[model samples]
Target: MATFIIEGGHQLKGSIQPQGAKNEALQILCAVLLTPETVTIHNIPDIIDVNKLISLLEKLGVKIHKIGSGSYTFKADEVNMKYLESPEFKEDGKGLRGSIMIVGPLLARFGKGYIPKPGGDKIGRRRLDTHFEGFINLGAKFRYNREDHFYGVEADRLKGAYMLLDEASVTGTANIVMAAVLAEGTTTIYNAACEPYLQQLCKMLNRMGAKISGVGSNMLRIEGVDSLGGTDHKMLPDMIEIGSWIGLAAMTKSELTIKNVSWDDLGQIPDVFRKLGITIERKGEDIYIPAHKEGYEIQSYIDGSILTVADAPWPGFTPDLLSIVLVIATQARGAVLVHQKMFESRLFFVDKLIDMGAKIILCDPHRATVIGHDFKSSLKATTMTSPDIRAGVSLLIAALSAKGSSTIHNIEQIDRGYERIDERLRAIGAKITRVN
Candidate 1:
């Protein structure tokens, strides 16, 4: 396993650019299977999860060409349909959770799709019921192989229908939208996930000849088209990475500029950090975070109650960045309550932070109360293992702000999301090294 040895207490400088959105890239890459024409995608992040999905598509006979550093052209002119049922595919498909998305486009265009039980972060139970149920609502037959832990959906022809999702799952909404775009009639999806990335997917599909409306709302209407054509699409900069950088700057007292962040799309992220008493300045499209030399403070509610930072659907704070927020709060001026509503196991990483001398109370599996050390006490470095991608990056941030050198094992989890993180941190005066 790869590890990161970080020299702590160093302040980072200069500017860092966020990579293409990993979540969006997964959906966009799967959409390429909807058309036989070349779909040129720009700003594709070179990360493990996204790359795994691309390789999975390539193995399924999608022709992929590298056009530039972060650009690729994909054409699914001759997809190997039988490959989906092969042993090699079952192994590959189970490696990443994003591989589940390919089933939608495949089932849409070819009338059938199959996937092994998808694997991803063990943060919590992420059920696939939303995806399969949506497909079933669209006139697809669903079957599961309990022995093999496999799922399959097939239909001779899909007929659109109205669906009110039990939950506004981002991937689930994306999958259903992809399937409905090629159905026989109009499809209406209420309670859809309206995150910016999902909106990007809808817009891209529109460019590819799929009729979709309500691009940025919870209700999505899609008028099915006979076929979709290929088009060029560019991915938005990863908002989660941008939030991480913000938290990193505050934790290490660094003056850093995060370049080319699409500010308009970063809903509630800046405000939530500001409530933690971090200074975030907008310089056109870039986010300039000044050094919190005196340490930041947490704000209380108007009624003078303790502040609570919780994750909800979009237009609210993202759950992915809660780990970062929790880590940064360790050195802030006051206390804050972080409630992770979506995932049960995400807060389990607080024990590692507590080992480093941070004042945190693991209230339960869903909540934690972080009392800021206020920089009067620096965290003592220690060796640890990464639990998941978000938690791994959070640990890396904690190590960077600690008093001595720290070692993090199983850094492959971090690499799955961030692109060349060590190299990028090194450029910004961070003393981070990747050890094999």
Candidate 2:
């Protein structure tokens, strides 16, 4: 495994651009299978999970071409349908959680789709019931192989119907929308996830001849079309990465400019950090975070109660950035409560921060109360291992602000999300190195 050796207490400068959204790339890449025409996609981030999904599509007979640094063209003119049932496919499909999305387009156009039990971060239990249940509601037959732990859906032709989702899952909503776009009649989905990722998918499908309305709302209506065509699409900047950079600047006491952040879509992220007493300035589309040398103070509610930061659906604070928020709070001027409602195991990483002399109380699997050191005490560096992507980046930020050098093992988890992170940090005056 590769590791990162970081020398702490160094301030970073220069501007960094966020990569294309990883979540959106997964959904957009799967949508390419809906048409035989060339679908050109720009701003594709070069990361592990996204690349794995592209390779999986290539093996299934989708013709892929590199157009530029972060651009690609894909055509699904001659997909290998039989490959879905092959042993090689089972092994490949199980490697990425995003691979489950391909089933939607395949079942829509070809009438059959199969996938192995998908694998991803071990933060918590992520059920596939929403995806399968949505397909069943659209007149598809669902079956599971308990011995092999595989899922399959098939139908001669799907007929549209109304569905009220038990939860507003982003991926689940995206999968169902893709299938319903080619069904026999109109489909209405209430309680849908309206995140920017899903909005981009719906807009792209409309350009491809699918009829969809309610682009940025919880209720989505789709009028099925006979077939979809191809179109060009550009993904939005990753908001999660932008939030990480903001937290990094505050923790390390640096002046960092995050370029081309698409501010209008960053709902609630800036205000949440500002509530932590960090200064965030808007310069056109970029976000400028000034050095917090005196340290930041947490804000209390109007009633003078302690502040609580929690995650909810879109237009709410994202759960993915809670780790970053938690890490930065260790050095703030006051206390704050961080509630990670989406995943149970995400807060388990706090023990590592506690080892570095930060004051934190693990309330439960879903909550933690952090008492800020207020920069009067610097964290002492130590050796650690990365458990997941968000947690890995959070640990890296902690090491960067510590007093001495720190070593982090299993950095591959970080690479799965961020593109060339160490190299990017080095450009911004950060003393970080990689070891094989």
Candidate 3:
């Protein structure tokens, strides 16, 4: 395992570019299986999870070629369906959550798909009922094998129908959309996830000859098509990484410019941070966060109560950045309550912050109360373990703003989402070293 030894108390001041969206890359990469032609994708992030998915695809007989840096051309001309039943394939599929998406495209084109119990961050109970439910609504037969802990869906010919999702799940919507594109009739999805990731997926599918409407709303319409073709696509910048960088700048009192962030796609992210009294400026497509040497103050609600930041569906705050928000709040001037509604265990990382001399109350598994230090007392260095991808980056940010050096073990969690993170931070004057 690799560990990150971070020297704290340095301000990072340089421009950094956000990589392609990891969430979008997962959906787009799996969507490649929907067509037999060559699909070229640009701005793909070279991260662990994505590379694992690509390797899984290759195992299933997809022709992959590296065209350039962060670009690839995938040809699924002849997928080996027999590979899906192999133990090696099942093991590979169980390693990443994104592997669940391959089921949609495989079922759409080959009439069947199989997946082992998927694995990802242990932040909470991530159920697959939504994905399987959507498939069942689209005239597919769903089966689960308890002995092997596998899920399978098969359909002779899918016929589209209306579906009202219980919740707007991002991955579930992507999977269903991929399945519905090649169905026999029109499909209507209500209360679907309308995040930028889903919007980009719809646009990419449209370019590839799939008829889909409602690109930026919760209601989506899709007219089934005979087949899809090859297309070129460029992914948007990673919103989570941009938000993390914003938090890092605020906590460390630095001036950092994030280049070419899709300004329109970052819904409510900047505004949420601004509520914590961080100065964020939009210079063209870039975001500039100025130093907060005097420290920031948490803003209360209009009715004069304690401020609360909670996660909701798209157009609301994303759950992924709540960890960053909690970390940065440790240095603010006032107290704020962070409510993580989606995941129960994500807030458990606050215990590590409390050990670093911050005042935090872990109210429960879902909520935390942070009383800002206001720079009156600097955070003392400590050893910690990264629980998940978001929490890992959050701890790294905290360590950077601490009084002394800190060591974070299990940094592989951070690398799964952020590409060359230590190297990227080093470019911007962050004192982080990766040691094995």
Report RMSD (Å) for each prediction in the order shown: 0.5, 0.6, 0.7
Model 1 spans with C-alpha error above 4 angstroms: none
Residue 144 error, candidate 2, Å:
0.5
Error of 3 at 369 (Å): 0.8
The whole-model C-alpha lDDT of candidate 3 against the native structure comes to 0.95
What is each predicted model's overall lDDT from 0 to 1? 0.96, 0.96, 0.95
Task: Give the per-residue lDDT of model 1 (tens digit) for 287-373.
Answer: 999988999999999999999999999977899999999999999988999999999999999999999999999999999999999
What is candidate 2's lDDT per residue for 223-331, written digit by digit as tens? Answer: 9999999899999999999999999999999999999999999999999999999999999999999888789999999999999999999988999999999999999
Misplaced by over 4 Å in model 2 are none
Per-prediction backbone clash count = 0, 0, 0
The runs of at least 3 residues in candidate 3 whose Cα sits more than 4 Å from the true structure, single-residue gaps closed, are: none
Clashing pairs in 1: none
List TM-score per model, in order.
1.00, 0.99, 0.99
Q: What is the lDDT of residue 15 in candidate 2?
A: 97
